[model samples]
Target: MLTGLNVAVIGGDARQLEVIRKLTELDAKLFLIGFDQLDHGFTGASKVKLDEVQFKEIDAIILPIPGTNHEGIIDTVFSNEEVKLTEDLVKSTPPHCVIYSGITNAYLDKIVQSTDRKLIQLFERDDVAIYNSIPTVEGTIMMVIQHTDITIHGSKIAVLGLGRVGMSVARTFSALGANVKVGARDTAHIARITEMGLTPFYLDAIQKEVEDIDVCINTIPHLIVTAQVISKMPAHTLIVDLASKPGGTDFRYAEKRGIKALLAPGLPGIVAPKTAGQIIANVLSQLLHDLVKERKGSSQ
Candidate 1:
């Protein structure tokens, strides 16, 4: 139980609600920042302004999945307040306070480093990424169905990158009877793709692989699907770029070519908020509990 722990949940969407609920149930004192417009309330959570939170008493700070933008501005879906997490705020927190976020940016990394506080990026964990891929794959399948006139059965599909999300997407599409081909830079990943009974191709040969693809799903964060690559694809092809914001696809080129392209980063949150929230809440609660135990042991 997080009996005496004080936590500040700052800036998030519906998924944060589950985190708040789980923490509150564990008896953590929660200071919910940037939730002014929310009507429902958790049992042990209180809405507070950023300036009003007593940072010295905070044991942990939770940030949204996107964490902060390049400017340290947090995304607050339930509030109109423009919340920004600055170095001063981190410095004000107790020396033992740990900051939790789904991901980080240069701005967040700099401030955390300057403050000398531990920044735990939940999305970096294998369990989180693997579990998240489930919803992501489901959402991708939904998008492909909605946008395409052809059925997934026997459709030529190309999945770029064999990371957690990429592997899941490729496997699911292949299971659906799509002629799935996965592109990877790593030889081990290519071998694994072949082991899975799906066609494997080196990323260098992406142009040739995409030439007749019905759907191209890119999980690589970098720009792999350039104008030149898009030029080789059939005009009826659909491209789903699941990387972070400003995904890998050349959106302008895809548009010019009259090809449909989608940038879907946080599909888990969008397609299954409750499940995604539970995943986060479960992991976060255990981590916070462990932190509490560690502090107690160190003090003794």
Candidate 2:
């Protein structure tokens, strides 16, 4: 139980609700920031302005999956209020306070470094990324079905990258009887794709691979699918770029070529918020428990 722990949850969508519920159930005193428009509240959580939170009492701070933008402006769906995460706010927190976010950018990293606060990025963990792949694959299937006239059973699909999410996406599509070809630069990943009974190709050969592919799903965050690569694909092909914002695919080129392209960043949150939330909450609960033990040990 996080009996005497004080946690501050700041700015998030439906996924944050599960984190709040789990923390509150563990008896953590929670100061909720950016939840003004929320219709309901948790028993142990209280909505408060950022300025009103007792930073000295906070043991942990939870940020939304998207975290803060480059300007430190938090993205919140629950409130109309604009909450900016400043270095001063973080510096005010106690020395033991740890900040948590799904992901972090250079700006967020800078703030944490300057404040000398510990920042944990949940998405960087293997367990989190692997589990997140499930919902992403489901969402990808949904997008393909909704946008395409062809069935997945006999479609020629190309999945770029063999990371945690990439591997899952490739496996699922192949299992559905699609002719899945995975693109990877790593020799080990290439061999693994072959071992999985899927075709494997070098990323540099992407142009040749997409020529006849019915669907091209890119997991690489880089610009692998450039205008030149998109030019080689069939006009009826569908492109699903699952990387972060401004995905790998050339959206403008795909549009000019009349090929349908979609940039889906947070598919898990969009398609299965409850499951995604539970994944995050479970991991966070474990982290908090460890924190409790560490605190006790340090004091002794």
Candidate 3:
């Protein structure tokens, strides 16, 4: 049980509700920041403003999946007030206080480093990424259906980056009778794509491969789908860039070329917040439980 643990959940959407539910059930003391407009209440959670939280007593801090923006501002959908995470606030926390986030930015990373506190980016874990890919694949399917008039069956699809999400996307689309082609730099990934009974090509050959595909899906977080790459694609092809913000595809170029390009990041959260939240909550509960045990052992 996390009975004695004091956790501060700061600024998130519906997913954080699942985290709050699990944490409260474990009997943790929760100070909810930036949830002023939330109608639902939890037993052990106190909805308070940022100033009201006793930072020194905090055993853990939970930031939203997106963490802070470049300017250190967190996205608080439930509150009208601005909840900024400053270095001073992190420094005020107990030495052992852990900060949990789905991802981190340069701003948040610098704060945790200077404060000498632990910062865990939950999405970095393989288990989390793989599990989250399920919803991601489903969301991808949803997007394709919503945007394109053509059926997935027998449509030529190109998936860039053979990462967990890319792999799932390729497999699912192929299973649905789409002529799926996956691009990757690694030889092993190429062989794996072939093993999955799909066409495999190097990322460098993306321009050549895009010539005939009906849909182009990019999972690479970087700018792999540049103007040159998109220029080679058929005008009728639908481009789905699933990377983080400022995704792989060139939005301006795609628009100029008269191709429909959609940038979709955090599809799991949008498509299945409850499942995504439970994935985070389960991992966090285990990690927090481990933290408590470790502290107890050291004290004894």
Candidate 4:
């Protein structure tokens, strides 16, 4: 049990409720930063205002995935309160305090380094990424079926990137009898796509490969689908971008060209919050148990 630790869960969506519940069950005293809207009457946790004063005794800090904004403003989807995770706020934490988040950018990393604190990125773990891909792919399929008029069988499909999500998308699409073609920068990935009995094309030649793709799924986080690429696609093509915010496709251009393009970032939370929450909770429990073991070992 996390008997003496003070854990602060700052902000997140529905999945965060599971994290908070699990942490509370572990006997960790939780200080909720921004959850005024949720009055689920959780017994062990108390809501606290986000201010410089609250940093006095926090043993650990947990933030939502994508933690803070580029401007360092932290958004709590469960509440209306706004908290700025400023450099000053970070520097005030105790030396032993650890910051846990899903993904961190260079800006947040700089602040953590400057404060001489450790930051744990949970999303970097292979298990998390692989397990998370299940929901992501499922959500993508759900979106495709919901938006498209044509059946997936015998349709020409183009999937960009051969990463975890892309591979899953390709395999699932292929299983449903779609002629799946994957675009990738790596020769190894392209070869793997072919080995799986699917057509592979170089990402540079993606436009040339797909002239009448029924459904195009982009897993790459950057702007891979430009106007030139969209112009090459059939007007009825449905583009699903599963990347982070400001996804890979040119939304404005797709709209202007009358192509059905969708930017889906957090599908797990939207489609299956319970499953997503459990995935996060399972990982978090293991981490806390490991921390307990480490503490016990040092004491012995």
Candidate 5:
């Protein structure tokens, strides 16, 4: 039990509710920041403003999945106030206090490093990424259905990248009878795609492959779908980019060419908050428990 542990849950979306519930159940004293507009309350949690939180007493600080942006601005869905995480705020925490986030940016990295604090990025774990692909694939299928008039049964689909989300997308679309082709940079990934009975092509040859595609899904975080690549595709092609913010697609070029392009990141959280939150909460609970045990052992 986290009876004496103090945790501060900062700005997030619907998924943060599940995290709060799980943490409260463990008996941790929670100071919920950026939840002023929330109507409900937890047994061991209290909604508080950022200034009210005593940073030195915090054992852990939980940040939203996207964490802070380049300007240190956090996404606060339940509050009207703008929450910014600065270096001074982190430095005020106890030396052993750990910071948890889904991902980190240059701004967050710099501050955390300056403070010499432990920062755990949960989404970097293989299990989290693989499990998250389930919801992402489901969301992708939903979007495909909503946007395209043609059926997925026989449509030509191109999935760029063979990572966790890309693999799932290819498999699911192929299973639905779509003519799925996956593009990859690594030879091993190309071989794996071929082994899965789906067509595989080198990413460099993407222009040739997308010429007749009905739908193009990009999982690469870089500028893989450039103007040249989009020009090669049919006008009816739908481009779905699942990469992080400022996705891989050339939106301006796509728009100029009259092509429909969508940037969808954090699909799991958007499509299935409860499941996504549980995934995070489960992992977080175990990690915190392990931390507590380690600290106890060292003290003994």
Candidate 6:
């Protein structure tokens, strides 16, 4: 049991609830900041305000998946409150305190660096991303089925980028009998796509290649699907962009042409909160256990 540890879970959604519950089950004294709007409550976790002094007692802090905004404000969805994750907050954190968040912004990173605080981004963890890919792919397939009249079998599918999510999207679509064509600039990725029995094309030709696409899934975070790319696609084509907010697709052009475009990020948490939370909980448990062992070893 994590008896003496104090974990502050601040500003998150339904998935964060799972993290809080699992932390409580682990016997850690949990302080949930900005969860006042949450209807259901955990047994052991206590709710607290977002003041600097109160946030100081926390030995560890957990922020939501997308940690903060460009303006450095952390959205507490449960409380309907927006708290500025300021430098003051970072400075107030205990020296031993470690911050766990999925993604961090430039301002947040600057604060952490200046304060000498430790930050662990869970999304960057290989195990978390790899496991989460399953739910993401499943949710994506569900979206594909719901948004279009076309069947996955014999569909002309274009998967942009060959990263973790891209590879998963392509492989799954291929397995469902779609003629998968992956767009990538990397030579290795092109080779890998070919080895996986999928066609690979360079980004320079994406505009022409997207002509008859039934479904285009973009996993790249950048703006790969520009106005030119969208203009070439058939109006019946469905674009599923799995990238983070302000996704890779040209939503303006898609809407202008009456094309169906869906941005489905955080699929794991939205589609399967329980499983998603458990995945995070399991990883957190291992990390905390290792940290405890390291502390004991250093003291000895």
* Alpha-carbon RMSD of each model: 0.8, 0.8, 0.7, 1.9, 0.9, 1.7
Candidate 5, position 284, lDDT: 88
lDDT-superior candidate, 1 or 3: 1
Identify the candidate with maximal lDDT. Answer: 1
Sort the predicted structures by lDDT, highest score first: 1, 3, 5, 2, 6, 4
- Summing lDDT over every window of 10 consecutive residues in candidate 5, give the lowest-scoring window: 290-299
lDDT of 4 at 104: 88
- N/CA/C clash count, model 4: 0
What overall lDDT goes with each candidate model? 0.96, 0.94, 0.95, 0.85, 0.94, 0.86
Candidate 4 C-alpha lDDT tens digits along 130-233:
78888998898899889998888888899999998899889998998989999999999989999999999999898887697998999999999999999999
Going through the candidates in order, what is the number of backbone clashes in each? Answer: 0, 0, 0, 0, 0, 0
- Candidate 5 local lDDT, 1-300, one digit each (tens): 877889999999999999999989999899999999999899999999999999999989999999988999899999999999989999999888899999998999999899999999999998889989999999999999999999999999999999989999999999999999999999999999999999999998999999999999999999999999999999999999999989999999999999999999999999999999999998888888877887789779
Question: TM-score for every candidate vs. truth?
Answer: 0.99, 0.99, 0.99, 0.93, 0.98, 0.94
**Model 6: how far residue 248 lies from native, Å:** 1.4
Model 3 lDDT per residue over 1-300, tens place: 998999999999999999999999999999999999999899999999999988999999999999999889999999999999999999999899999999998999999999999999998999999999999999999999998999999899999999989999999999999999999999999999999999999988888989999999999999999999989988999999999888989999999999999999999899999999999999999999999998899899
Can you list the residue pairs that collide in candidate 6? none
Error of 3 at 6 (Å): 0.2
User: How high a TM-score does candidate 4 get?
Assistant: 0.93
Residue-wise C-alpha lDDT for candidate 1, range 96-169, written one tens digit per residue: 99999999989999998999999999999999999999999999999999999999999999999999999999
lDDT tens digits, residues 1-300, model 6?
676777888887778877888888888888888888888778778877877336677778888888988888777878866777788777887777788888887877898999999999999998998888889999999999999898999999999999888888899989999999999999999999999999999999999999988999999898999998999998899999999888998898889989888988899988888888888888887777666676678779
Error of 3 at 281 (Å): 0.9
Candidate 2 lDDT by residue in tens digits, 1-300? 999999999999999999999999999999999999999989999999988987988999999998899999998899999999999999988899999999999999999999999999999999999999999999999999999998999999999999999999999999999999999999999999999999999987888888889999999988989999988988899999999987898899888889899999999999999999999999999999999999999999
Candidate 1: residue 22 lDDT (0-100)? 92
The ten-residue window of minimal lDDT in model 4 covers 51-60
